[model samples]
Target chain A: MSEFLVLVVPMWVVFTLAAQGTILSGRTGVFNVTQEGVMALGASVGFLVSYKMGSNLVGLLIAFLVGALVGLVLAYMTTQLRLDQFVVGLALFFATTGAAGLLYRQVIGVTMTPPRVDTLPKFEIPLLGDLPLIGDALFVQDYVFYFAVILSLVMFWFLQHTSAGLDFRSVGENPKAADSLGINVTWARTWSTVVGTGLVAVGGAYIPLPFTGIYTDGMIAGRGWLVIALAFLGGWRPLYVVAGAAFFAAMDVLGQKAQVLGLGIPHQFIEMLPFVATLLVMVFALRWARQPAHLGMNYDRESRLVG
Target chain B: MSTMQKSETGPGGSPPVAKPEARGPGILTNIAWTVVPYVASVVLAFFLGGLLIQLMGYNAVDALRAVLTSSFDTSFGMVETLHKWVPIVLCAYAFAIPLATGKFNIGAEGQMLLGATGGAAVGITFSDLPMVVLLPATLVAGVLAGALWAGIAALLLVRFRVNEILSTVLLNFVSFKLIDWVATRVWPDAGAGHPATTPVGDGARLPLLGSAPAMHSGVLLVLALAIFIAVAMRFTPTGFEMRAVGDNLRASMVNGVRTSRLAGAGLVIGGGLGGLAGAIDVAGVHGRMLEGMQSNFLILGIIVGLMARGSMLALPVVAFGIAVLEYGAGTMQLVSAVPVEMVLVIEALILLLLLLSDLVRDRLRSAR
Candidate 1:
């Protein structure tokens, strides 16, 4: 049971971080679907940089910066140029995916045996980790896990209570109104995009740095898309997004546990738990979910009409 | 919102010239406005791709030359290109149709997988049947399975108000596992080591067209379908309605068009074509359903559709262009040790440039 919790909790952290990024971008009126490809690039690039630098922390920082840079490009294209968000996002996804693969091949070369990295060290809290039942799952983990959870809380507080957060949400809800009120909608959305995508890259970097310690082409898998689903499931709220991530993560771990226990059911069906859960959650929970009014619209300050 | 229409370069941009008696220069200028930017984008992408290859310490020109000659120069390469063209063309059409009805059917990968699975399942099950019975049955099964998979998303969207984009994407993951189950457990080939179904009988196989470097006859089927789609979209009321709905959902609703129904039909047709692409791969190329045969067709098909800009006539040409890049990239990888994923880089660059070219086009028009 401890082993199961250990496996499940980290995934929750990774997914929570990703969902937070989605919410951030979505709040800024950019439906960034490039998460999957960005994560793939993050995994590959993060793994490569760490391997070369011999410092996991440095690799993660570089990964976050790279993601922010990509986000900057996406922001410029979508907001400044008045291009279609979905289309440009899709194009960015492809570009990042290809860039990752190309860079990997160029740097690593094709090898009969792929290389592996050491997982980030886990830190057990002094007293809190000694508690029964949930201690190990909650208190003992890599720094990234704590960062992910703390970041979510921070994001929730930052988005709800802060005046800057109100302005950000306003820019997303009605850019023209925000602009009329002296808010720079373009700057808010662009910064949100950069920060959100950077956070997403951290989630991506977590896959290789702390969780797997090895990078493969399929390392990111569909977790990036799952992050988007969870964000929607949480109604674009930070805390509920964490809960949604945890639910999907638990389902994923449970499926593996069922396979281990040989529960007489086909493992394939069990493997589908996360996706099915996402679908169910969306269908039932989305009724109460509120989206940014201009979630995927391109904003132009010169144009009086809402995009 | 309507009053804010500025000098934007996108779908709203119009020629600056006042109405004139001379229509010939106007049409030529319009054609140039569209064609020039697209051509420039494609050329830039190829040049950038070559530059990347050169930066990796390989001869960029050599790699590109190899791509051209290996995929189009020789008879074998030409035949292979045509063989590959069948699936690309079908998949692009699948994506294009959905876009026309304001649907983004990103589940082409899932639909294609189910199509292949359905084709192989029927083909192997009725191995004793004659060609006429077995072949058509397999194709029909493929089409139905693809449509049914897409229909799940459509139903969810229309009935429950679940977004089709999210539903379709979720359904793709489901289809991947479903196909895996079918290939590995349901009809695993007796002596085969990999996750694959038993081979289809000869009767279900598509006939070859030529002697040496023979291509499957599925190309003919795809061509006929393309022509039909072109005529339908160009001349028919149904196609016009789909386009109208795509243009403005609220306006179409106000105008009494059944937007939901059109959305469903677009998905069905799109998914069916995607399935047919997979079916052709099985019946024409592979002779059995194999795990991971879907490859990058979904993304490639979407890119092709986008490049075509909703023109049925332009779809095949774009698909061919993509096929060339894909095939050439493979050869480039072999010769220069460059990653074939570079094709994706080139495609994305082309798409981004094209999107930005609207700005460039507007600037040029204003200058004129």
Candidate 2:
């Protein structure tokens, strides 16, 4: 159980960070569908930079900047030009996905043996690390895991307790109302999307550091899509998202271990657990998953339409 | 929202309706308006792609030239391009059909694989049957399988209010695992040295046309289907309802249109077309279900569908252009050492530019 938790935690970080990023932008009416592509770009850039520079921290920072660049484009197109959010998001997804592969292939070439970097070192908390089964799994972990925990707490507090957070949330619930109340709709959307997208990239950058220490094509796989589902499953709430990420991460780890578990079932079916479970969960999740009212719709200040 | 509606209405939106005297020059200008943006976007995308190639230390001219000319330079290349066109266009229909009802189907890869698996199952089970009975059975099975696969997502969206995009995308991941099991466990072709099923019976194969490097008859079938789809979308009541729902959901619902049902039907039809692409590949090209057979067609199809911008008539044409770029990507790599991904990047650039062109056109029109 301890070993399983150890495996689940890092995967949890990936889900938590990405889901948080998704909801952050989602709360501003900017439904970011580019997580899959942006995450892949993050993985490639992170892996390459880590391999070349010998510093995973620097790699993650650069990944965040790159993801922010994409977010900037998405924000400009949707917020300023009033383009269709989903369409522009889909287009950016394609461009970034292509760019990820292009950059990796150009930098690494066709390497017979892919270069590797050292995984992030773990640091055990003094008193917490000495506890029972949960101790090693939860307390003794990498900096990113700790960061995910604190970030979630910070986000929950910021959104729930702060007056500024209410102003921000108002943009997604009713942008025209927010604008009428003197809140800067475009500013809220742009900053949130940029930072939110950057966090998603940071989540992606974490993927290479935890297990493989190398990046490959399709490494992000459908995890990026799963993050969107996670956001919905959590009702766009930070605390619930953290808990939901644990469930997704467990499924992820279980899928990876299916071949070795020897459960008398085909490993393929086991590998499909996360996606299938999400599909099933969504049927119920949507009942209470109150997404931002204007999610996936562009806000046109000059338009007479209610949205 | 305005951009999507504008794109659906075509480049300039239904020319003034009251200007009978202006119709003469209006027709020419309308044609110019449509043609110019497409041409300019393509050129600009290529220019950007060339710059990237040069920065990457490759010969941009050679890479760009190879990408543009290779499909026409040789008969084999042309045949390959046409073969690529078969799946690309079918997948574009898979995407565009649903978009007509304002639903996005991102599970074409999964649907195609399931279709192939279904076709292979039928073909393998009825290996001894005559072609007259077996071929159509295989194809029908594929279509049904594909439709069933998408129906799950459609059902969720209609009955439970689940997001179609998430459901469709998640189903794709599920389908990937499902097909892997089918190929490896159910009909494993041990000799193929890959996770693949055995080839279907000879009766299931599509007939070949012309000489060496001959084309398969599936191309002609898709050509016919394309014409039918274009006419149906423009003239049929169901198509009109789908368009109306997409253009304005509230108005459509107010007017007694069953918006949800129409959206569900669009997904099922789109999935059926996606399945046909897989089945055609089995009959015409690969002759077996195999891993990786989906071959980036999902992305190509989406790009083409978006480039067509909700016009069913433009899908096949856009798909053909994409197919040319896809077929030439390999040659460009060989000639100038530029990666195939560069073509994808270029295609994406073209899509972005085309979208930007809409904004520019809107701005200019308002100014005038």
Put down candidate 1 lDDT per residue, A1-307, tens digits, no spaces.
Answer: 7777788888887788778988998887888888998888877888889888887888788888889988999899877777777778888988998988888888889899888778899899999998887889889988988888789889999899999999989887888889899998878888999988988887888887655687889777678888888887788889888878878889867765656767787777877777787887777875788788888887767665555
Candidate achieving the largest lDDT: 2
Clashing pairs in 2: none
Q: Which stretches of candidate 2 lie over 4 Å from their true place?
A: B1-25
Worst 10 residues of 2 chain B by lDDT: B8-17
Number of the top DockQ candidate: 2
Going through the candidates in order, the fraction of native interface contacts each one reproduces equals: 0.52, 0.64
- Please write out the lDDT profile of model 1 over residues B1-368, one tens digit for every residue: 21222233333122222236647557667777788898998898889988988888989897887776687677888778887787778778777788888778888988898899889989998989999999999898899889888888888777777877788788888887787788888888768777889899888899999898888899888889889999898689998898777766789999999999899889988889888888889999999998888888888988888788767878898898888888888888888777888779989998888878878877777787
lDDT of 2 by residue, A54-121 (tens): 99999999999999999999999888877677878888888888999999999989988988999999
Q: Which stretches of candidate 1 lie over 4 Å from their true place?
A: A255-259, A304-307, B1-25
For candidate 1 chain B, which ten residues in a row score worst on lDDT?
B10-19
Q: What's the distance in Å from true for residue B79, model 2?
A: 0.6
